[model samples]
Target: MSRSTSTPAAPATPTTPATHGPVRIGAQARTAQRPTVDPVVSGGFWYDRRRTVARVAIPQGPGLLESAGNLHDLRLAAGAADGPFRGDYPFMDSDVYKWLEAASWQLGQAPDGEHGAAAEASLAEHMEKIIALVADAQQPDGYLNSWFQSGKGDGPFLDLRWGHELYCAGHLIQAAVAHHRATGADSLLQVARRFADHIDATFGTPDSGKPVDGIDGHPEVETALVELYRETGERRYLDLAGYFVDRFGHGRLGGERYCQDRVPLRQADNVEGHAVRQLYLLAAAADLATETGDDELGAAAARLWHAMVATKTHLTGGVGAHHDEEDFGDPYELPNERAYCETCAAIASIQFSWRMALLTGQARYSDLIERTLFNGFLAGMSLDGERWLYVNPLQVRDGHTDTGDDQSARRTRWFRCACCPPNVMRLLASLEHYVSASDGSGLHLHQYVSGRYRGETDRGLPIFVNVNTDYPWQGRITVTVEECPDMPWTLSLRIPQWCRDYTLSVDGVPSARTQNEAPAQDGWLRVERVWTAGDALVLDLDLPVRLVEADPRVDAVRGCVAIERGPLVYCVEQVDHPGGGLDDVVLDPSRPLSAKDRPDLLGGVVTVVGAGYRRRLAPSGWWPYQDRTDAERGDHASPVGTGEPVELTAVPYYAWANREDGSMRVWLPTD
Candidate 1:
């Protein structure tokens, strides 16, 4: 399934779908602005990536699911096949649901943009077959979970703490919503609603007096139930979601931090517990706040987000530093080599951030989304869209012991707990939905990508702005107002947090509206004017290599520095430094750092070359422990050999581990 080193061949498709089943804000939404057209990425970086997804990842999903016994479990639940459940985890069906979601998005996207007409038709055929298989598997009571249905878990709701019954249902409902919205097909939606009805009747609020008093160990069902309410306008569905959200922190699940039931949502000061579970629960909290316009809930959501950013988040916008439970650690306990920044957690972080952006209409939420998308989430999947990494670590030592089958030290075609690859697929397929949003009166560019952006004025008139850029690479973006209302409307372009200096000029001239060559507010450059056709503005953020040092509190890499250019974090792999491995390499900030475009390497990336020295350490001793004052005494352990000058080549962090198996580290020692 590995692809060639070069970019894959994509058919010529000028028109991509404008929206990939964007979030539909109901009247209950409290946000000041919502996305208007779901701005499509018809060209450039994301489009090309989507092309790779359609060509390989999305198409390969069904077969992999079949081979892994995901589909067989579904059939067995339906009494069509006789076998015990497949997969080590109980949540295997979620992967198929995710795959279905991705396939639906691919079918709904720009026709033939990536998939040829015949390919599209074939994909649709497989998608329908899978959908039918899922629909048939549902029990008469509308409950679905291949594991429990296979009689593998005794019965439904019996083991809510360990069983992922609700979690799997959540994914099924999400896939149904996506399918319904994308293709205007309600078959899956109908199945999902039946299950939702069953869940609503079974699970009860604190006052409902239902026999079942437990929530799932996982938090996904809460968010999915809220989305179902948004889709179906069933207040009961929303109430059920609220029930699940409120059920936390009452000693349920024994108040275990791993299950995120230890602290109440509104009272929690910081994010804790399993990273994905905590984020998913908070996402549902955001949804609850949005629909109900609860100020307290909204404040709590924002406060928790700030706490996570300041305490637990990685430089790559990844979370979950503890490897054992895939849990968040104490503030600044980020260990580079042992980081368990699970790929699913990164995706969950994006979901949470996007919801925050819509709820608050602030630029910071999108900022995290951009960082996670470019580095954390992107690093989870291979460039070829075949292999995937369950966890994304910042450092891998030379001869790193890869004990697990799906270890992060190397890419695996599939994981025993394979949630990340299909999750990646759905995100890439629906990426345009996260690019930009509108306030009903103006447009707001969130994540910068080269494409055709469409929004609208408050008066219902459509606005179109064509954007062209090399983006994340060369930072100059050409924006042309193709169509706009005669009335004045604002165009707010985001100045990424990484960008310290940039210039903006309109119609080939410096505009007088600029305020001291800086972003107007909240990392945004706002321009208000009565736009006309063909009016153009050029934004230049000439990307350059930057050396970033971690806070002293981050003990893992306090004296080290991570290389960055624009949105990309860079890492040195052992393959690139054949002479001296990355373990002992040290970067020197005083020396020159250069950025080079190497189309011949790693499928055409802009690599950063830096001046560094390889340290020669004392040979390992039987007793490695040394006194703290040894350096002061000039012991043999200190600087045993001369520092050898080495030219360090760093590729984008997302592109690491794509080559030969060797050492890799993002944060290099600078001392």
Candidate 2:
């Protein structure tokens, strides 16, 4: 399991399927053709460059990488032959292995010293140590896992629903693939294959005499197996992956008792259930369709994407409606106060959206990613980037303190299951991968952050893009293109869904075209003249304050509304109004809210000021159903609510909890 510093071997060529199996309900069976890797995974801006720079700016930067690197080093320290896992925390130990594997694949894609050789070595050592631990704990039948292995005598596979046996296997398979790809080593791959083969042999066959339940409590294995099939080109792996997907909604898989069981996978109208698990399953299904050429599966994924965006999604592109269930609420039932936007869910949603964008060539998918990245994803980490918010609520009640019982529904330093911290670190460390993508014909500019990109277009033309702009804070983006080949190539600039109006400029010439303009003649802006290094394009999107109200169906807020600018949802904190309750808050949509730049606040957030009323106690006289009530209850007074005019300020919901520990609410009742 321990990997050497030597370079990894070339990726193995995919094999042709000798025999074919019947396609299960949701399964995409492989034929004779070999499966290819997703272009998104193979080529993208590296994560280390795009996400890590911002991450290291936070307070916990040292511990973030230290923990991850330590985990990685432990594996390498243990030879591929044998070593101990050597970690006090079992969950962290497991995650360290996962990160090592993911990091390995990234390193293999572009092995350079920029990522730090020492860091890489440490990761390899940790991986090796964990593999040795796995080997020592593995059962004779090829089952491997420390937690499950230890509990075998009393109850082996007794609680597959919550135990996460398959989930661990999925991570193992992922790490194995990543390490093999990065180091060209087979020791870990061999171990992964044995475990995978055992899983395929143990689960899901009418004749195997094992349980026929096709679903996993955690939906990761489906995606992992699909990746394995892509890497190995083995038909069996693809079949098994498909089987998991198909078995997902059928009664044979024990129905949707856990999550999403009420409806079949293909028939499910929206993204629901555990936030992370649902998105992972969707991503895997998308990969399966691409790998197996299953049009039906692809259509299902597309429908799900649209449904999520249209109904379940927030203005910031965050999903997962209710904090209580950590699941989807009724369509358009988005309540800011009760919103439980888990950090992991946002990451998974972005992954799923990115995959969809790749498959369909739609800018909307990328648009969603941009929204989530700027808002929901950004909210996951504190301004300093050290502390993390497990649950990102749309609204925080002013003066309200969260009790420990609702930790999952609030932000915290750490959790008993501290998966998000490291996960956030790794994601941030590798954010560059999500920026722009090339399809050979043209380059797709998904996000508008200031940066430079050098990559080959799908047509193999060397393309260089240097973008300069202040994004999220400002809407101006200047993109310079160079190295155009003899043949004309198109460049697709994403027009964000939120951008009601935008101006386009080519080579410094302002075009009259706006968002309403017709699609470019060639399905892309045509630059007939031979392009030079200085060729430039400028885009300006209007980022203005916009009022947002929840659907009438959401019972939590019958007559309330929230505000948003760009992708951030705004909230009114009690700190802004010392004694005035949010209930006294009301927005006069007619009176436009002004946006003022306040750099003094977290990350230069935009503040919106408006006129509203402050609630005050009022005296009331008792009334009776009959006309004589005034005399019968003479001089009797009761407390009644009254409002006084006041000025209110609102900040982004993501920035609320970062300020003074006071209550905040997103939705304010209007009188």
Best by lDDT: 1
Query: lDDT per residue, candidate 2, 384-436, as tens digits?
Result: 55567777776666445576642444556655455566566545544555666
- Residues 1-671, candidate 1: write the lDDT tens digits: 12222222221121111222223233233334565454566666677788889888998998999999999999998889985778887888999999998887777665653336778888889988999999899989899998888888768998888899899899898888888877778999999999988888888865777768679999988888887877777888888888888888888798988988898887899889899999999888877777766667778888999999998999998899887888999999889989989999999999888888877777888889988998999998888988999999999998788876765578999888888899999888878778777766678888777777777887768899877777777888888999997999989888887787778898999876544344755577888889899999988885878999888999999888999999988989999888756788888778889999887887778999988787766677897677768854656333523378888899999999898888899998876
Q: What's model 2's lDDT at 386? A: 50
Quote the positional error of residue 475 for candidate 2 in Å: 1.1
Worst 10 residues of 1 by lDDT: 10-19
RMSD of 2: 7.9
Estimated TM-score for each candidate: 0.94, 0.78
All candidates: CA RMSD (Å): 4.3, 7.9
lDDT of 2 at 553: 64
